[model samples]
Target chain A: EDQVTQSPEALRLQEGESSSLNCSYTVSGLRGLFWYRQDPGKGPEFLFTLYSAGEEKEKERLKATLTKKESFLHITAPKPEDSATYLCAAAGASNDYKLSFGAGTTVTVRA
Target chain B: GAGVSQSPSNKVTEKGKDVELRCDPISGHTALYWYRQSLGQGLEFLIYFQGNSAPDKSGLPSDRFSAERTGGSVSTLTIQRTQQEDSAVYLCAGRGGQGRSGANVLTFGAGSRLTVL
Candidate 1:
């Protein structure tokens, strides 16, 4: 079975603070690792997709990197608008279709 | 529609009652997925339909929960004898294809919040 685990269930940071979220996974024949951001009362929004170790993708204030056994989402100088739940998921080649997700890390950035 | 659309944005039901949730995927998308999200929990895969191929129902929690896709676009999830534990936000998403590029990204709907009492 594919398992995805995230650390630091909740994070509190002042505006402009930078930190990173971790996602550990054990997937058979890993295919892709995904990141998503979700706000209260809203569905998650797609963020990035990492296909292999050492691969990285970035957006406005978020950068996602993947390794052999884990992935990291680095937030650079986060703002209040960046407060949201960060979710990580992994899809394996064996099941090519199913995605296993983590509990998620809820970020609260206060300005 | 511009993106994945789910019906009955909010629902309140009693135990033992059956409820049906609907999903209308994006145009020309061949892959559709249904997931359940409980408070403070990760998304739980429910089912997925890819084109004309057989759907993957392995993620379904139980036999009471069933889903079907019609014409390879819209989908309906039916939960019979709903239980309190079944209360959650039901999310529907669609992927254009299996490619690693844009086609692989899943576009999600606002989700249908189901509350069973």
Candidate 2:
């Protein structure tokens, strides 16, 4: 089965602090790796897509990097608004390109 | 609409009662998907529709769950004889009709929170 696992189920960061969240996946013929941000009571919002190893995408203070076996989302000088659950997903040909999302990493940034 | 829109933002019901959740995807999006999010579990895929055709529904957990799309725009998910375990946030997403690459470009709604009593 295709699987996406995230580390540090929850993280607490002070204002202006920086950190990174890990998402490891095991999918056959991986097609794309995606990042999403979800706030409480809201659905997920797309962040980036990494189609190949060594690929990276950035938005504001968030940067997403991909490797063959894993992906990383780095938050730089995070603000309270940047605090949300970060989700990672993997889509592969074997899985019909359906996204399999990770449990997610909840970051709490206090200002 | 501006983005995917789901109706009945919150629904509270008793066990065994049936419920229907609705989703109006972004205008012109031909790909639609439904997912379930439990308290501690990851997003669970339920179904996908590509221009009114369900190419895959293997993600649906049980027979009690069924969904349909019309005019390639609005969709509905109906749960028959609901159970306590069915309580979760049902999310709806949609994207362009493009091929494989477009499959990952999904736009989501706020989701409907279902609570079973």
The local distance difference test score of each candidate is 0.91, 0.92
Candidate 2 residue-wise lDDT, A5-103, digit = tens: 999899999999999999999988888899999999899999998888999999999999999999999999999999899999998877654899999
Compute the DockQ of candidate 2: 0.69
Candidate 1's DockQ is 0.57
Native interface contacts retained, candidate 2? 0.65
> CA lDDT of A2 in candidate 2?
90
Q: How far out, in Å, is residue A52 in model 1?
A: 0.9
**lDDT per residue, candidate 1, B1-117, as tens digits?**
798889999999999999999999899888889999999899999888887454588889999999988898898999999999999999998887567632257888989999999
Where is the poorest 10-residue window by lDDT in model 1 chain B? B96-105
Off by over 4 Å in 1: B101-103
Interface RMSD of 2: 1.7
Clashing pairs in 1: none
